[model samples]
Each structure stands twice: as structure tokens, then as C-alpha cells.
Target: MTPDEFTATYREHYPRLVNLARRIVGDQATAEDVAQDAFVALLKATLHDEQTVPRFLSVAVKNRSRDVLRHRKVAHKYAPFETFGPLSAEYALSVALFIDIIAALRTLPASQRRAIVLRTYAGLSEAEIADRMGWARGTVKSHTARARASLRRELAEVA
Candidate 1:
């Protein structure tokens, strides 16, 4: 599709995506930022089809929410790497999953989580995320891969 079409899609879907992001990210400002960034990426995309729009949006929102969570965790100095041990395995797994998601997210150098969230949650095309992030598509793909791998490894160790 043409640039105009992309813009129109962004306009139509941005509010919905923002609402979704707000639910996960838990604030208005960060939600707006995530929505804006996602739509900006969508605006820059070559929308060869429209059927995948929902998927694209979901990924973007999820990715952005995760970013906000990571930022909040770091800004608050709530690092889980510090030993707070002696919890049981089940409780430990639950807590670790929560912390693991946060720690894995913090481990990302920003770009990786962007790619990971977009791909895994928002279901965005790598090309679209790359276009939005202004990186090569392959870079988007690898960042996603690494992010997933890291999360799995980190969570498993805690488990």
C-alpha cells in the first residue's frame, strides 16, 4: 500500500493500541508513547496487506509495555539479581517468572526488547519494526531471537 494508506491506518488504530498498551504499561504517558511509537512505525511501513494490522498493533503495544516495565524497574532500583533467596520452588518459580521477565527485559539494551515485543507479542513484521526503529530488518529479527533466548535461560536458572 501507499504512504497515505499507511497514515490512515495509523490514525484509525492508534487509540486502540494505546489503550491496550496502557493496560500493560499501567500509565497514560508511557501508554501514549508506546502507541505513538508503534503508529509511527506503522506509518513508515509498506503495508502490502491490511489483514495483519491487528497482529502488528498487538506486538507493538506489548513491546512498548515491556519497555516501560523495564524502565520502571531500573529507575526504582528493584534489581532481582540481588539475593533474596530461600523461597520454595513453586513460589520461587512464580516470583522468578515475574522477576525473570523484568530482569530479562532489563538485560536487553533497549533495541532487543523492542524487537522481541513487536515480534513475540505485537506480531509485527521484522521489516516494519526495522523501518520504525531505523535498523536493518535482520537486526530486528536477531534482537528478537536473542531476547527470547535470554529470557528463557534466565528464567530456567531461577526455576
Candidate 2:
């Protein structure tokens, strides 16, 4: 793609790509970084079919997001104390609650988790999620419903 073409593609897809990455990684800043990296990688790659660029970028973001999540898990396992820094009591409590929520999200099945995150965090409507996920609207609704109930139960148990 030429510079102008690339710019247009970025403008069109950047938000959706960032939302996808955020759903996977659970961090907006990191999601934006991952999406930018994917676009940069696409710019570097030589493609025989330019039409496949969007799909390629999406897959690239997904892979990068998974890699980041894996790295975070391993690092947290080995160096849990490194994450703790100076913070007010209220801030620390909020962080703790966020961690608990993330843990609850992890317990969900992959489809349910994705549905919940895409709906709640990414703020995508059911139809949008259905199109992106290649599922029927009903499937997205079911997944979101079940996931919400599961999360509510889990959080209540924690409380």
C-alpha cells in the first residue's frame, strides 16, 4: 500500500483493531501500541494481494496481544512483588478490585470472556460484535448474558 492508502486504512481500522487488542490484553495503552505495531509490520511486509492487508493486520494484532498476555502472566508469576509501588490506600484498593475482576474474567470460557469484554470494555453493540466475531446476534447475546451472570456471581462470592 502507498502512504496515502496506508493512512486511509489506518484511519478506517485503527479503532476496531485497538478495541480487539484491548479485549485481549485488557489495557487501552498497550492495545494501542499493539495495533500500531501491527500496522507498522504490515507496512514492512510485501504482500502479493493487497486486499488481504486488513485481515493480515488483524491476525498480527491478535498474535501480538497473546504474546503480551503470556509475557505478563510469566512475569507476574516470577516477579509478583515488582508490580507493587507507592500508592494511596484508595488507589491500591481500586487496583486490587480491578485485579479481582480480571481474575474473574479469566475464569470464563473464551467466547464468553470475549463477548463480555467486547461489549463492556470495547463498548461494541451486539450487532457489531456479531459481525466481527462471525457469529449470529443471538449467540453474542447469549454469551454476554451468561458471562455477566457468571461474573456477578463470582464477584459477589468475593465480596
Candidate 3:
């Protein structure tokens, strides 16, 4: 599709797509990200028909939402705080804190978010992240450092 057509399509359907994802994912920011990802997929697609674009985007959003739900389930299953044994006060507090940390992570810039997730969640080293992300080691270090500072500030505010 033409740029103008794509812009119009994005403007027309973005909000509805986000709302649909939000209903599935139960998070506004995540829904927005999911919708944006769908748009990116639409751009990458070869389809050019106006009538097919919206349907394509809708399916993309739903698929991404399902992926997010699956990831959430896996994360919850392996959450470090789950080692607390039972639903005690400490377990509840830990779960709440983990949720807050995730929200804070979402508020970070894309580069910072990627760096932090690779380092913290995936247990990758700075060199490994740099290699995987196709960046210099210094760049990875900077992104992770900035991400850490931002997360500290965000989590502090939550506390």
C-alpha cells in the first residue's frame, strides 16, 4: 500500500486494535505495544489491498496478544518469588513487587528495555548482548547502565 494509505489505516484502526489487545492482555501499555507490533507486521507484509489490511492487522494483534499471554504464563511459572512455598504475606508482597518491576521495565525506552531483558532475564553478558544486538560492547554497557538507573528510579517511586 501507499504511505498515505498506510497512515490512514493506522490512524483508523490503531485505537480499536489497542483496545482489543488490552481486553486480551489486561494491560494498556502492553496492548499499545502489541498494536504497534501488528502495524510493523502489516508494513512488512506484501499485501496491498485496502480491504485486506485491516483484517491482517486484526489477526496480527490477536496472535501477538496470545504470544504475550503465553510468555506471561511461562514467566509466572518460573518466577523466582514462587519459591516462597505458599501464599504467605511475604509471597504476596514479592509477587506485587515483581509486577511493579515489570511495569517499570515497560516504561523504559526500547533499546534500554531490550538490553535489560537480555542481561537480567536471559542472563546474557554484556559482550553476548552486544554480539546478539549487533552493537559494540560499550553500547550494550551504556544501554544496560541507563536501563538500570531508570529501573532504580521507577521502582523507588513504586516503593
Ranking by TM-score: 2, 3, 1
lDDT string for model 2 (110-146, tens) is 9999999999999999999999999999999999999
Give Cα distance to truth, residue 92, candidate 3, Å. 11
Q: Candidate 2 lDDT (Cα, whole model)?
A: 0.95
Query: How does model 2 score by TM-score?
Result: 0.52
Q: Which runs of model 1 end up more than 4 angstroms from their true locations?
A: 44-48, 78-159
TM-score of each: 0.44, 0.52, 0.52
C-alpha lDDT values of all predictions = 0.81, 0.95, 0.94
lDDT of 3 by residue, 1-159 (tens): 789988999999999999999999999999999999999999899995668988999999999999999999998888897563579788789989999999999999999999999999999999999999999999999999999999999999999
Backbone Cα, N, C clashes tallied per candidate: 3, 0, 0
> Best to worst by lDDT, what's the order?
2, 3, 1
Residue 104: error of model 1 in Å? 48
Error of 1 at 63 (Å): 1.0
The stretch of ten residues in a row with the least summed lDDT in candidate 2 is 78-87
Write candidate 1's Cα lDDT for 32-74 as tens digits: 9998888777666666678987688788779878988998878
